[model samples]
Target chain A: MNTPLLTVHELHKYFPLQGGFFTSSKEKCLAVQDVSLSLHKGETLGIVGESGCGKTTLARMIAHIEKPTAGEIRYNGQDIFKFDKKQLKAYRRKAQFIFQDPYASLNPRLTAGTIIAEPFIIHRRNLAQDIDTDLENIMKMVGLSKDQERRYPHEFSGGQRQRIGIARAIALRPEIIIADEPVSALDVSVQAQILNLMKDLQDEFNLTYIFISHDMGVIRFISDRIAVMYRGRIVEMASNQQLFENPQHPYTRILLSAVPRL
Target chain B: MKASPVLAVDNLSTWFDTEQGALKAVDEVSFQLDAGDTLGIVGESGCGKTVLSLSIMRLVPTPPGRYVSGQIALNGLDLLSLSEREMRKVRGKAISMIFQEPMTSLNPVFRIGDQISETIRLHQGCNRSESHHKSIEMLRLVGIELPEKRIKDYPHQLSGGMRQRVMIAMALACHPQLMLADEPTTALDVTIQAQILALINDLKRAMGTSVILITHDLGVIAENAQQVAIMYAGKFVEYSDVKDLFSLPLHPYTKGLLHSIPRIEGDYCRDKRLPIIPGVVPELSRLPEGCRFHDRCPDVLPICRNVEPALIGQGFPKRYVRCWKYQ
Candidate 1:
């Protein structure tokens, strides 16, 4: 739609097998190989894969959290790697990441308010007057009370910690969020709450989501379209209905079949 | 009298004596598993599924974790009455357990063969060469390839799935009459999860061993267990046949748990709002006055806020539901 919100061309990330200052063994592990995709303005793109399949590497490269060995990422038709310092900062501001482990992602020492307000402070947004009000609103939107702002990460449950993570991710009102298995670490009942909250937030903010998860049920429930990755490449990409119904690739079929149904 | 079940637990309440208060982790949980039948304990984290299993195995550390009151009978023998020395003998012989994380469970320094054979040596009193030979057979039984060579490799040398298989081999090495698998496949991939589950099923069938399968996934419970117990806040909220429970879940907690999961099947759309239980599982230290699930129950009555409901059923004939409405 409108030149696609984000695009990746032949993305490749290779991790060195052995690293030393002098040794150049040339043996590398292909984490992400020849991955390519385009994100729409306000749609959830699900990337499903088993552990060690390099979906995280792809997400990191797209968010510019990690550098790709070979490929190009264009945000609004301009190559993000070629961006100047200010342009990079602006791009980073528009794109934020939510990690799988909420406990690890958040700083344990800081209060919830401080963690959520860090984005605004780091972006150099002069919201000293309205920052408190904004933080409270974000917390409320994530199904957390305003009183919880004073609590530390250790005080919150797994679900509440994730809510804090989401509050931080959306603090800057980013157009795109690359969430790497955000609900994987939560319980099923809590997972449902977090998933519903994400949907509500997406509708309210009109944000695009790059949802990555290993659970087929979660990906099916959240994504508009799905990409099934095997080894280090996308074996199949299709609309949610088509992928679940048809699933052309053998690996995709295997993945769909592996999911235990009630 | 009819033959007794392989394992029977009655009014078992495992509590942790904390400075704040007594945390009832497994409160008055009662159930039984027959020969070769898998009794699946379905619950989210901190719902006491793991604690119940640990209580059965008599593995809970005593100073902190004390059984308030109950009986844990394995093959009609009271396990709770056993001394630590005697319980040690019962552990790997009559009962065995496999934990969730295989990587952490397996000793990194020990070779796979040594780990598996150690159980055999400790339980069966076999010599080193005999134990080593039995270890190879055990590995082969669990479908590990090249058992002779793979047994020499350390825990780190194996993949996550392979390590789990090794763990299974060690657990089954003693050929225990009953097995406890606590989230055995939780850390593995879905495809590997399926394989491990299928392997457990096949092993149970072949060995005629009663299994207590505990997990958070309803799908796993539906596929694996014959009888199912839905645990919440240290109690069995719902207990019934897997088919009956899935077809007609009675407890609000059980029903909410069923509806909460995003099924990978028909009529489930993408990105639509899912049915959710209102809040998180309450901390055991500060559980509500009356019903544990009343705060999150969609169909809460005024009585539910003040009066707790007992698990209502006659000896698990059809089903048991712990709800005021049912009572």
Candidate 2:
């Protein structure tokens, strides 16, 4: 498809299982195994699964937040793992992450403006003067008032805090945004608002998204194509239409049917 | 031709005395639930669905929470007039509750078996050994595999779904006449949530237990509840049969909630934005003067902002709605 924007090849992540005193051996928990997917330039690819199903692990590997035990992540035809120090730092600027819990992901001590300006302070060292303007634009883009920047995370509601999180994600104008269950913690009414905001921002910036969530409704609402993960493996991958209308895999059918619809 | 209701709540108001003012968490809400019927109370967070259930159970903390005025009757007996000691007997024996987060609700220090057995023994007055046996049976009934081994496992040893099943087992140990499930599946996965919902429905059918299922998901309510109540800002905005409610939702807030949810099966609108209620829920202490939802109501009238509308029934089978549009 015209040389995909990003390609993940055979990603595998394993954590060592802590054995009891009597059993002294190397045991591993395979969090994500042989998971591979390609993301187009301006389309959203949703990875959906239940808790502990390795969706989060796969997202972390794709975002380069966590190093895969065995795999290759190619961004713009170059392996991300093989990047030198300078190249890796540049790659970090190209991709940003929005965490699941708005309450825990943000710093409680810092004001919203300071938090949004952090990416610029860390990455664009010479853009200190433009940080304030950049932060204000990003906040407005995410539907937050300019005055809200002075308030702490605790002062804002869950939906507003999530908006602040989104503002921070887009502050650096990253090419790819990996949002992991970004609206799952908010109320239903507010969830719709956040999802709508995300769609608008995606179009305005022409951004690619790797949206991860367990909610079929949310995934269906936001994604162009979806990859279903089960037990650390992608059981089915298809467009949103095909996956919802004619699910091929039994597990996929079960997952689709399990979603409570209005 | 109407059977006696298993539960009838009249003029129930639960308020909390916060630092600012008296916060009416649950306003004067009234509903009658027949035995074996599932009544779903659906609302967003801070809408007082949880507080309504808590008020029914008399579990609202005393210092901050106070029952303004209400009558909660279970099987024609008023629970509000009962003493603390007497209410304790009615808690686990006649009525039991399942909370939202199973992780925190289950005592981590105790084994799964001990917690279930404790409920059984306390309510049924059974001996230790008998309670243990019943606990195992309850666990098996909830479809937990390897109940014999799982009985010895602590709450931490189980997954989220398994922990919820243990909570169910504890709640159903005595076969209580009424079960109050407050967002019981909110914390679990979709597959596990489906299983839990099915199990609850099956058990309710088998035991003839009426359920007051509290959740924010209208979809869940449609599948499980026969009667549905839509709450907004601590008041029952609409109450009707599930089929009728879904087919003909009267209140603007109810319609807003129904339309706000994205459907999985229907025609996909790829680019269309979801319709959302604009304003946030008002704080309990400073609720809007008239209709709690008038600020966000699309069909709002001048009267709606000045005077509160009473919940009035429309016709047969009692379809109740509190809105100026209806008046």
Candidate 3:
């Protein structure tokens, strides 16, 4: 647990609800309010919240896809917010994000192989020929056949498309992978397959995942630790088993009660 | 046996004639739902869950998709025989639908009030103001805050959960006898998913609305459905009471599905690794000849690969399964 990979302290993200160009001010909707958690090396910390609970916003900030309004995001003891331009460029390789919708994330025109190899082309110079071998390895790791790499996103089913998304995310071999609702779009039966694949890949790669999801069952399955968010704040953060067995926060209890009994 | 059920679908088969080949989407599926009864259809994507709902409504577009063979009897009236004009009358007035994507299901350009009121005015022959009042009441019934002001907002303005609630309100606007909810909460978050399920159940009990809840989540089905039908490769592999299906699943596929869910309750994961059902659902165009699930099934006897298993024995009183596990 001492091997902390990333630490977020008093993170805040506020979006203006209403505004005019010059005349009027706006009401601020605190999207993420004072949320703090630490991600250990090779560990998955699952974040669970309702639709507007700012989980995705928090994820975007952590992945540096969006700048935090206020907070100190420490990556390997260095404040990521205060990173120099060169250091920030280096940070992009260490933390990558896997978006929720596979179809949305991927370009329809590009082949799966091209999509996976794009990151390599962006970061590593003179890696053109190596793309094929790297792509094949990524595709195999995510349970896709070699033949599947040539196909477009539309050709594959929802589950298969998600697999390609996973391949693209892990292709860069980032230390931290932030998967945002990766399996929510999938079917219940297909969900198990994707989750299992992720678990396997996590162990094999020794990767850290900030798994974001709405399904309590899924969070329980993949996460070592769980954080329950409410309107904007994390009400409870503990081990998965502890939170599932003895949920303390009122919102957490409400969420637990709402999970459909199987 | 003397009294036929309220809704009887016998040997229902729907197919799509794509450029590739004739893909049988829903094949030889049969079931009956009495008045005020809920039948949950569970299946993986591309297993014809949506097609089943659309086929029953006779809404599958004609060019690519076709309901080739089926007898859909609603209260002893054969629905498949009805004309499109007649089906339109029966659609909102008799059988309503709450589609999966709420934002798309409701017209975006129109106001929420207009969409709901338009449905009421068209179906129930109410005036504009009257329909508006009724729509607002429906919105309040679904627990939307400030129904009057909220109903004026467009679908895009509202959050995902709010949009879903508006969709529910619109679907119930006409007070149909039976409602077909196809992955209704698939787009919403878990907490919101629970609220929507509870709302549907409350409305069903209050209005005695018989429902065919089609979803892929067993947890949602187990929570809401009294009866469940397990679909695989466009066929019903198992059907029974919810309790019975959970307690003693008759089919291997059903058992695998039930066990595969990463449950929060009970001792599910004995080992550290989650219990996973390996292999993906087969492509519809390249389906196997015999038992559809034979390839992925854990307990595969020799008979599984060669011949298809018929729905044999009333497995759990009203239960049925198309697996040799029961035989």
Judged by TM-score, which candidate is best? 1
In model 2, which regions exceed 4 Å deviation? A19-24, A126-129
Q: Which stretches in model 3 have alpha-carbon errors above 4 Å?
A: A1-3, A22-24, A127-132, B1-4, B126-133, B144-153, B156-158, B266-271
Model 3 Cα lDDT, one tens digit per residue, A215-246: 88888888889999989999999998789888
lDDT per residue, candidate 2, B83-172, as tens digits?
Answer: 999999999889999999999999999999999999898988889999999998999999999888999999899999999999999999
For model 3, how does the per-residue alpha-carbon lDDT over B1-327 read when each residue is reduced to its tens digit? Answer: 555566889999999998879888999989899777899999987889889999888898887988788799988878999998899988877888998889888888999989889889989997889998999999999999999898898889988888888888888888777899999998887778988998999998888788999988888888889899999988999889999999888788888888778778753342256566778788788888689899999898899998999987573577888988668
| Clash numbers, per candidate | 0, 0, 0
Q: Could you tell which candidate, 1 or 3, scores higher by DockQ? A: 1
Ranking of all predicted structures according to lDDT, beginning with the best and ending with the worst: 1, 2, 3
- The residue-by-residue lDDT of candidate 1 on B1-327, one tens digit each, is 657799989999999999989999999988888899999999989989998999998889987999999999998899999999999999988899999999999999999999889899999998999999999999999999999999899999999999999999999988899999999999999999999999999998999999999999999998999999999998899999999999988999999999999877765464477788887788999999789999999899999999989999845575899999888
Candidate 3 chain B weakest ten by summed lDDT: B266-275
Error of model 1, residue B229, in angstroms: 0.6
For model 3, name the residue pairs that clash. none
- lDDT over C-alpha atoms for residue B214 of model 1: 94
Clashes of 3: 0
Task: Compute DockQ for each candidate against the true complex.
Answer: 0.77, 0.71, 0.56
Best by DockQ: 1
